[model samples]
Target: IGSRFSADTFRIRDFFAMNRVNFTWIDIESDPQVDELLKQLQISEGDTPVVAFGNEWIRRNPTNRELAERLGILSTLKEEVYDLAIVGAGPAGLAAAVYGASEGLSTVVLDRKAPGGQAGTSSNIENYPGFPMGLSGRELAGRMTLQAQKFGAQLSTPREVVKLEFENGYPVLYLDHDKCVSAKCLLIATGASYRRLNAEGREQFEGVGVYYDATPIEAELCGGSLVVVVGGANSAGQATVFLAEHARKVLLLLRGDDWGKDMSRYLSRRIEQTKNIELLTNTEITRMTGNGHLETIEIRNNRTGETRMVETRAVFTFIGAVPHTEWLPEGIETDEKGFIKTGSTVMNSPLWTAQRRPHFLETSRSGVFAAGDVRAGSMKRVASAVGEGAMAVAFVHEYLKEM
Candidate 1:
């Protein structure tokens, strides 16, 4: 018998344990005698491993990759139209979907790429609550997606929203190639994008040797090789710590003298104790050189006017992120940095003050709301995003009721 829970089976465990193989194991072995019993029953060949699900032969020595593809577990088709249309399938959007659908509102979530915005790119998130052991950003996003879908939230991936407009007091969302979707309400959960270095050859070597976010796919390319990470904030510090675990050496290049003071103290201490990491202050990448892939990065020391070349297989940058709101209408109130602005009062609150007024998460344009990293004054965290998303929905209800 085969199980789809544990990885105690030697063959299946070894196949996934090898980093070279890009496959995930989902099952475990039940009993050695079961294999022989199946052969005796003329159901399977005794020479190879076999799986039986209720007297039916499901597989024979099948690799996990093959099983995943055959079972349609890799990808599935998505439906269109929803009562509540959510743009950006990150944490905020997923949270809203769960609450909206569970509350009997038809919800639809769309994303330009895979779910889990900037937070998904993280290798491990230790600060999130409820998990003392810590969890990967990918895992957290996956759980949220499952929870949302369980409550009837529809998800559409690899779809981009091109424009947003209002028709008869209802918000209409437009996708690439003029695909339009009208909804009772719209939530701008479209998170932010990382700012690129714009160095020569940086574009050409994007997937081959350069990456904006440190993920498992990018980390695998740095096996036993030197890696360069550029940034000074929490993201940079996190990347340096994550890369240092797999790479032979990690060079952290900061534009200033010290790590961003806002970085968590525990993370700062870990980076200091890690012997494999090298800290370079007041430095910047001047250029990059490679034919098909990146071989060496040229750095400029701002203080000494000196240049140095660091040979490495891969470079990960986490400098900062830019909000994705260019398509939004100009009438919508936003901060100087382009983040959506909300009123300084809680929705449906009876208390009001002239100076210390309550602000709801309503965007400059009435009836439109912003949440998560896309909203101004938002605390960039998974838990915080969920809270903001739920609160925004309450405001949306109030906005519609008054209108």
Candidate 2:
């Protein structure tokens, strides 16, 4: 009964579903047993989201780290050091951990949030290999996490690595909460985040009508309202398809002339075939207007120079990706767009004074590497990220031998 109005319930449900956490929801409005239990726990009907894990019961929705701690998966790092430290739990980091631990190296993988990164939030990954039927991004990431841990790689979540520096010959990282750790080698595989719209009033409607991701958490908030999805990539197409299930109408705004130019053939066909999905090419959002929540958006046609306002509460963007390299040290060279420089490309850097050229996927800093979307000139695909991560482990072995 309260599901429609409660964003917290949808968030909790979506997070659990994505992480593959086994848990049940009790409405308490219908079940007498659950109602009585809620009464016992002093959780009234107004408090709809009372999550229980093991012996602990949280009155409010739990964050990802809190859930991990309750489930006994978040490991305590303490003062323990490692042979290799990965600063992201996306595909690249997970692959490195799986390979690093299986090859007898002590590895620790840390992520600021949950393990899946951006790819984990996807509803269905049809293009990824071995999954013809298209399993969820969460399932793939959860399986990889388990495989990494199965080989003895330690994972710590919701832990942010604020800064990195070189201490002696090893790399040292300072994380949030005054925690310091060191590793012989480091991998900056934080990947990329969803780029935000540069239109006016875009910030005011965030979390209200505009969202970067169209996962169920955001979809549930739209509540059959007319939705507008920006960008023409596969991620935007996926969001459009997923949002169409709940949104009354889905409008895809493409700044380019051809819809299929950036999107996958399959997704383009699906968007073209969908009845409720409207495709507007050479379009761009000029402004967003609302009292507190986004009520309308003004769009411009780049080709025709015509402008019009549309009624839409939800706007999802899946445009270009910007790498997460701000926290990286100065020695680790990055492109103008902040993607880490790797392989022979590092040879162009003045920092590359070593006798041997940098190994493929190795960053400008010796013993430091990069892969996935975070690496400069990398192919933005899950398979390529996995391949680079596994390949980086081989170079790690060679670097260690020289050490």
Candidate 3:
């Protein structure tokens, strides 16, 4: 149980949802029986957001690491040196894990958060092959994770690879809390993060008023309330449709007039047909105003010089994505936008030390490969990422023969 406006509650809920943990949330402020339940359990309101497991154990506002450990989802390195180390647990990494482990390679997949990465937050994906009715991103990720684990792949969660070094021409990863691991061949599939909304007071209102993904937890908070969605991409389109079902009304704010330019046709058609979603083109948020949470936002029309106030409690941003490559080592070459360079691009880099040309997905360093949205010139799609991942494993086999 937790307060409706608590950021910590949102964080916990998001983490649980991303990890596919089944739990029900109770609002202490709204639930009539919460006070009595808390009294019986000897939990004060000050120590709220208590996580109860089967009526026997409870933790009040526990950290993510603590919760992960309790759920038995967190994993530790098993072998001294794994045959293959996959970074990021998104589609690319998970796909590689399934193929690598099935081929008898000792593989371990590491991710800072849950298995899904940004795609995990998607409400619905229709274009992916198979599944005519479509499926939620969490369900797809969960299935992929289970398949990989079924093939003997070790999936480690809530672990960040902070630094990288080389020992005997093999990659050594430095993780958080002074933990480190080594692997014969490394796969860099650490995907991208949603670009932050540039509106005023965005940072202050984050987790409280502003959000990046529209999950069921956020949907509950915005029920019967006005919510705003920003961007013109497929992510924004998906959010607009998903939240429109719960929110009283949704305002889709776009900086450009052509909303369908970056979004899929089906989503754009749905937005047009939805009665609750108001499409605001050539508009941008100028300021965000609220007392402690979010209350109102000032928006402007770039073409008409008209300004208006939009009263909203939540704002979901899906503008674009920036690769999570800042922590990557200098040996890996990236393009101007920081996406990892692979194949022919890597061969042209001065860091290419291998006598033979690097494989299709190989990076500048030998025995290292990159795939998914993190790689430059890659098609940013779930199917393509999965394909690249499986193909990268094929290249790993060729690289292993030389070693």
Local distance difference test scores for all models = 0.71, 0.83, 0.90
Residue 84 displacement (Å), model 2: 1.2
Residue range with the least summed lDDT across 10 consecutive positions in model 3: 70-79
Better of 1 and 3 by lDDT: 3
TM-score for predicted model 3 compared with the true structure: 0.97
Q: Which stretches of candidate 1 lie over 4 Å from their true place?
A: 1-81, 345-359
Top of the candidates by TM-score: 3
Worst 10 residues of 1 by lDDT: 345-354
Candidate 1 residue lDDT tens string, 133-204: 778777788888889889998776556788888778778888864567777778899888778986766776
Candidate 2: residue 22 Cα off by (Å): 4.7
Ranking by TM-score: 3, 2, 1
**Candidate 2, residues 360-402: lDDT per residue as tens digits?**
9888888999989899899888788989899999999999998
Better of 2 and 3 by TM-score: 3
- Sorted on lDDT, highest at the top, how do the candidates line up? 3, 2, 1
How much is 328 displaced in model 3, in angstroms?
1.0
